[model samples]
Target chain A: MPQGKPAVVPTDGLTTRQRRNRPLVVLHTGDMKGKSTAAFGLALRGWNQGWSIGVFQFVKSAKWKVGEESAFRALGRLHEQTGEGGPVEWHKMGEGWSWTRKQGSEEDHAAAALEGWREISRRLADQRHGLYVLDEFTYPMHWGWVDVDEVVSTLRARAGNQHVVITGRYAPAALVEAADLVVEMTKVKHPMDDGQKGQRGIEW
Target chain B: MPQGKPAVVPTDGLTTRQRRNRPLVVLHTGDMKGKSTAAFGLALRGWNQGWSIGVFQFVKSAKWKVGEESAFRALGRLHEQTGEGGPVEWHKMGEGWSWTRKQGSEEDHAAAALEGWREISRRLADQRHGLYVLDEFTYPMHWGWVDVDEVVSTLRARAGNQHVVITGRYAPAALVEAADLVVEMTKVKHPMDDGQKGQRGIEW
Candidate 1:
């Protein structure tokens, strides 16, 4: 698409600014690596615009955190100290965050994901953020841990100008139908095809 | 693919560390957004790893710069002040960088793009940065302004552990073939499809 120009203008009876300024529900889903990375990039953009960024990461490797977490944390600190950009809050499951999985209570991944979903739902209700990143959220919906219909309805009814971006594989049909923008990251080639192991920095 | 696991392992007779440490030529291409966004996200990861980042943007709209540039510049400043992350250098085709289009001569788009490619080539030879982001570079290749064979060979011959990421639509088949990791961002759905305009912070 051309910069700032929609291919077609709807007769939705809204002004150009109104239509442009409306919040978005962007979904990045498919079998490729850049899903979460792209979502983090959106967070960077949101931070620059002084939009409060809330990232809720779910069911990732328990071993090591992705690199974006540390970078965003630094950005958050920068915002607090110098007020250069917007505020940023990074939350990941299994990290003992206040909203993280209940310790030793929900060992099952599905239940833990469901718990995370509930926390996000509550925050959405309270209008806690301008941009919400549900990184790797599709697994729960795909695995039947989270109700797809419930998610769709909740997002549809979300209050305020909160833009939500969800990244993961197998995004539910209902959620995609309701989303404002969706990109499927498809793999054309991978270093692993040549027996190369994933590298530091680039992979994490 | 599972985290840190390859689907198939080739018999390249190299140690895991050596294979993993090898530099990658990553290409992001297709008819959707998130190409450059994903690349910038990788730059964030690279910075965290103390890898110098060099971003070269080509053929962008003159009206405004993307949000990532400002954020990266701020990160660069952070690194310079506190020895935190890594050094960052952002270069765009216009706006007159020292290596940018030499002002009066290159009136045509192709010539300017060619000049930009030459600058990147020189930087690669110098091993100037650990990670190079060729933002919207495929446009030049697709338009035949830049040579794909030369790009592939130069990247293959590049010294040191330098990772290069090229992003844009309509990537040349040869370049994709040469790339170690290639992601095609396909549009499952777009806000423009619903007659909505792109918004700041999200679109930029």
Candidate 2:
């Protein structure tokens, strides 16, 4: 016998109702050029769908040149382009959020980034209204500044309706294998390897 | 113009020479399921390519079920299935990790997970191998026990020369956006949603 209009049918480890858990999408990549642009583009689409999107630049410290921050931050501002309400908020280092000196031992940098991540996650969890993005997060891990298991576990525990995006290279195998989707950007060509250093606005 | 092999065209931010740097693959998901299986598969493939492979599972604590622990410890027993290695080395979590059950705040959990990520990242960095996998990382983050941003940054920093994967569910958006690959698994139909809960050997 079935109850009156059950929200979701129970199957395996998922419920009909729970199946509606807005899917957790994991995109693992190391390439920045088109990957970052593509991520921002997808984020914009998600925002249009009424998802609250959070943009988190994990490894690119706030101290980076203003040009770099602006370029990345502009991605978040796309919400405005959609004519959505509210503006993209930022949590830069030394501004409410804990700060990490750009120069430090691998351990120190990792510790500071971890602290930054904690703050970002807290804000994302509390917001609960849209999508959250953690940018350049894989940097510290690649450099041995953070723990892969702990980060993976914490991410798994997010409750309520929310979507998160983490960018950067060297994503731990644990994260990639567990992801529902994986888009690898194999470098086909670029101007950097030729000594064409990153330029403001264009390459930052 | 176009000197020295056409300026060493950069693909996805790396030159052909740098392409030697294995692309980092992150497998982030919830629970065991296909996480370990995928890692074993990748390692076997890389091993065939004559590339040294390293597998590291970030066990949050030593309280793993006896059967589960034994099974993981015996992963290398199937080297024949992989066809290229005498035995894959396994590094189980030691005293360098712990979970503070009493600390339930999101911040506390993130902090603990950050510590764990740092510890694991340290080991990964030392290896400098071609492929590495961080399993069950999302467990801590999902439980609010890890710093997601820190984990992402760490992964991004050491991406070059080493391909990595992170596995878990509820993957932070920052991770998905940062990754060169993004995979989303939708439980279109599961037994749990149909009333059949997890079964032994299958779900465990």
Candidate 3:
């Protein structure tokens, strides 16, 4: 409800237009749910603006399907058929790279995760999409499968106005410091605390 | 990243189906952006499952239009025309209730907020929607316009499986306690801190 000019005004001496045009690095991390949901929401906004959307799912099993993936894929098709919104590319590391790897092997998971990051890094370098959603990406970093320093540096040096959003719990301090916007989803209460399970439409 | 049977398994002896069937009261309260956006994302999920979607905005000005509103409305229309998704009803208290009230008067704003809440309460009683999004509703209670205790009691006693999501900053402690799910968006960093104003597609 507090409004007006924000307390942090641009001390960087950039013109208003320059400041407004800069791409952002957003981090959504914490124990609570909705981090990936919020990131997907942002992607929806970007899609409406004709921004190409790239969604990379890191840890979610291939057997699991979320509502956003279907919705975005449909929107992607809509864009293709009638040029309505924006294009969407959805990739799951579990299905894409880990299928060939041993299912429960830690080393195989780590390798697949690194491969996923490599692909994302390549996309960033090539400016492949307008919005990149690294869904549940913090796990690889937390598990030491991917290098946080490399991720930070690559994002910092990313060119153009392509926005990147990383969502997961236990985001590293280094990544938090590197992000332009960071939101921690603190858990005040959860139904699971009262022994309630997640519902189909609600949880996914 | 932590997964398995959630730590809080139902000690109440409720079946898994029974636990999943209970409706949720969710609160997204914080200073950071994306509270309402996340709620809209949930609405999108609900819509895909053929759930009626109700979005009520309490504090945002009528002139300010966010992308989710337009997107959800279009999806609603698509559902009607093609039998896809679900119905949507969006109402903004700023335009709907406060149009005749003095713009800057605190008392008038408070009164308008209460009237809006009354309408939502009525809808809840009727089980009018599958998902009710009370966007920025916390401001009224924070400003002492609406009674927080009354809101809590009404929600607790309400029947039916309709889910409710309330989003705003400064949510009352009592409301937090009553909610089945609560997520506090803690701000670690924001571009406004660097003096950048909200841009066209990204902000609205």
Candidate 4:
């Protein structure tokens, strides 16, 4: 059954329609897996709504090809060809600050992450995408490559109705506080705890 | 960065390939949203790996149209036409046991849920799909419409490398104990807390 209206939401002034239309900032974090996967699922939903979707991979190596990238790209191509669904743009910091950057030193990775954030900030300012997924974005912030305060402020000041989702472990407290929705994926059990390894498809 | 090898996996006894190939019973449970969405994301990954994906929606109303359903169905059609990706079959219990049962009484719903589980059990016996997503399945077992003991035993006895993922809130304790991976999605904050409602695409 759907949960009842939360007590935190005041029923005094705002109309139901107004409440339904509010843009959201979602954060998915914790020690468990599926944080990025859930964010991608939201992106898939956004794409189906004909909403422009942007995916930014902060920590995954460019060489590591995740399935959502392939699937979303296919959907994006379908959109371009028949005007179906929505456009999708995926960027990886591992590829460098720009898609053309293939390899770099440790300092370069940090620099690239900052540059990636700069681009995301610009996109937020322009409201370029209806849904933005910062997959594993918490790491860069945790590593001090991106300023959490600036991120919180930029997200707070973001224009339009664009929805943003950040996924990774140990999300900064400030970001969590600023987010309209926060889901902590707690690990109750893991195969790794049983000496099992992640396989293809299941892990990627 | 990818996590190092799991210490639980004995280094001497099992080869890395053997360790990576173990099938998993994954459970996504708790109050927060995105449980089924994460399973669909895994199906996307499995599809990309050329694995047949079966999605069984156990509780969502048949009238509800989730984006992952559209996206995966499209991908399924693509596979049929061009032999790319993998085949996909999506079944909804809300539409009746076989996706054609529209409206029904309360007892009818229970019976339909049982019938759905029967089919799933058969598929598990046959090892029909590489990835089997029992979306919102916990509710049926929780309601006593489906036998949790039977479900657990059948899953344990199932053949092949098929992976099963069950998603919903209030997952039974037995199932949790049986699962190789269990993630409890805790809600830290929500827009609904501020009187915001679920929107199309994002909610479905």
Candidate 5:
């Protein structure tokens, strides 16, 4: 159970306490800066400390093209890592998107996104991981598209024993205030306005 | 002439009225999704008008590492689209990061980021691009790192004849509100957290 020590010796080489102290992380979603990479780094760091982890993805609706793209991209990365070469497994929980088929209206989108959040909160509370990355969890709130109260409650419930990371643009003021650490990415310069397009591998 | 017209028409394919109207777009700084790619899509939509365009990139700092990675990943895709070979040309502006000799403070990092922004904005205002993308421009603001008021004023000053895009997280609230359109990317799910590391041609 001790870190860097033989079964009998209590050398100062490493402290088991440090290893056990790795907290859970909940990553709130933001744009494609380095959230995924950062989350991966944290998870990898936790893994090194002998911690068990679980991942959950919440979305407004499964039917949206963007959702599919996000899922495929994330899975593609997962395949490269696990080297298992099988289909990426994700537990899809929540009511499907009703807004897509409904008349395109602000209300419709808001309702659907809110429903998605409730489902995600329910699922997130059920699992335990050293790090929990709530990816893109802010869009609903950012757009006034989801219920803030429900989300706050869910996060509060997981406050203990979980180092959560929430990555998203327009993070709610409340959420920002709650975070122990906050990182914001600012776009300084890029190459695309010059007529460059998104390459499959790099931009996605 | 109107759309779906014959090429030999005397008035040309586009009507005079149509030619005079150019789309207002929010472009990316360099890559797709951030600001550049988004701009490209908008430009492509406008290409039907056959409008003569200008594109400019501000070289504020040398992007040796990010550039190399982007080149390796986006080269093939760029060749296919533009019919040009090898790495995409990236503009490097601004002086690079300046660090304290003894310690690294948050302020120091912010100052460096703002220096980069100042140079980027200088370039954005001087030229006329059908669309302009200010990439990685938010670093200064996100870190509380730069003089955001200046950036906002400069951008506001240059309004018409060009569609501008501000990418990166931590976009100044002033800029976001001023933007006719703001699209934020929230990370909902990622492969990296599932033990997948960054792979070549992906996540670059």
Candidate 6:
């Protein structure tokens, strides 16, 4: 058995392996720190499987370099040079994604986020990556910059075996309902509660 | 700022940077899939910081080759050869641990798990690694194999800045209280409920 018994078995006609092979739209949402980090962890597993990993960070502060960014960048380089693991493409709201938009063309944050979604949508259609990490992507949807219904529908209708994992708080009910795996990372304890500040290596 | 503003600032006498450098004991518990994967992800970040990583898997199923095992093994090799990232040590309940124990010399599962805990306790006393990931360690405590109070006390009294992350369901209250950060991975939705089975890559 691949895993232990399920809590509730459905009457879906598909065989166990068929059901197992289904693409997953995993949503990690809650007011906690490990959502994105867990998604990155999932990306590591997928990468081990030779899955092309693509990470799109929606809240792209230029100065906010999380530790995963550097580690994954090194992984991407390793893949490029040594053909070890799978390909990794990390795109934040930086100049590395595309240069079609002018630097001072007055492109607001919302437009840029929407454009990022568009790019991801195109990739989904083409089934570019085996695993997609939409880090902090639910914020734009929660803020109404991106349409939740459209995201749900697009992900539902995505082509091929592309597994997408989205991380952020306040995930829309529609998206949650559409997700195959939804993990609400509730905080049982946090150092911040004791007035302690976040630390490096652990927080990032 | 290492991280965004906290929900509440503490009155601790330590400065921000001082508080920031303190080690963390993170606990991932509850009925979910991504607990170990998330801990592995955190280890990746710690590895990027050049933190020596020590992962001890108490559930020593030779058949269960989790994706992170291969990925992190590659990272360990990369660090060894190229001096990139950090060093990693992975120990399972296999023969590689030591030669003191005879092969299948009537070592029951409970005794094996207890020995594993004792070894980890010794390592904690020595502050052996920058990050210690005790994968699936709670089952031993829950099953009355390893002493929960001992684990709690040992982790609390751990020296230096060694970060320890324990993941499993049925975490004892003492361990929860001793943890600096605790995440309860509640499953909002799961494909298994729909009669789907756990697959490779995602489930492993």
The numbered model that scores best in TM-score is 1
For candidate 5, the per-residue lDDT at A65 reads 21
lDDT of 6 at A40: 83
Ranking by DockQ: 1, 4, 6, 3, 2, 5
The sequence of per-residue lDDT tens digits that candidate 4 reaches over residues B1-204 is 236577564755777787688788999998987787777877788888889999898875654446888888878887888777889998877655554445443457677888889998889888899999998899999999999999999999998899999999989999999998999888888887776777776776
lDDT of each: 0.84, 0.48, 0.81, 0.83, 0.41, 0.81
DockQ of 6: 0.58
Question: Taking the tens digit of each residue's C-alpha lDDT, what string does model 5 give over A126-185?
Answer: 644444545556766777777666666676676345556555667787766555344443
CAPRI quality of model 5:
incorrect
Count backbone overlaps in model 1: 0
The order of the candidates by lDDT, greatest first, is 1, 4, 6, 3, 2, 5
Ranking by TM-score: 1, 4, 6, 3, 2, 5
- Candidate 3: lDDT of A24? 90
- For candidate 2, the docking band is incorrect
Interface RMSD of each: 1.6, 18.0, 2.1, 2.0, 15.6, 2.8
TM-score of 5: 0.37
Give the worst 10-residue stretch by lDDT in candidate 1 chain B.
B97-106
**Top lDDT hit:** 1
Q: After superposition, how far is residue B80 of candidate 2 from its true place, in Å?
A: 66
- Tens digit per residue, CA lDDT, model 4, A38-131: 8888787888889999999897465444788888887888789877778999887765555444555445667788888999999999999999
Can you write out model 2's per-residue Cα lDDT over A18-40, one digit (the tens) per residue? 54344454454644233343344
DockQ of candidate model 1: 0.70
Instruction: Report per-candidate DockQ.
Output: 0.70, 0.03, 0.53, 0.65, 0.03, 0.58
Error at B96, model 4, angstroms: 2.0
- Lowest summed lDDT over 10 consecutive residues: which window, candidate 3 chain B? B98-107
Clashes of 2: 147
lDDT measured at residue A4 in model 2 versus the true structure, 0 to 100: 28
Please identify model 2 stretches exceeding 4 Å from their true place.
A1-21, A61-87, A93-107, A124-129, A193-201, B1-204
Q: Judged by TM-score relative to the true structure, which candidate is superior, 1 or 4?
A: 1
Residues B33-104 of candidate 5: C-alpha lDDT, one tens digit per residue: 223323322322222222222222232333312422232223224334554322222333243333223223
Q: In model 3, what is the error at residue A40, expressed in angstroms? A: 1.3
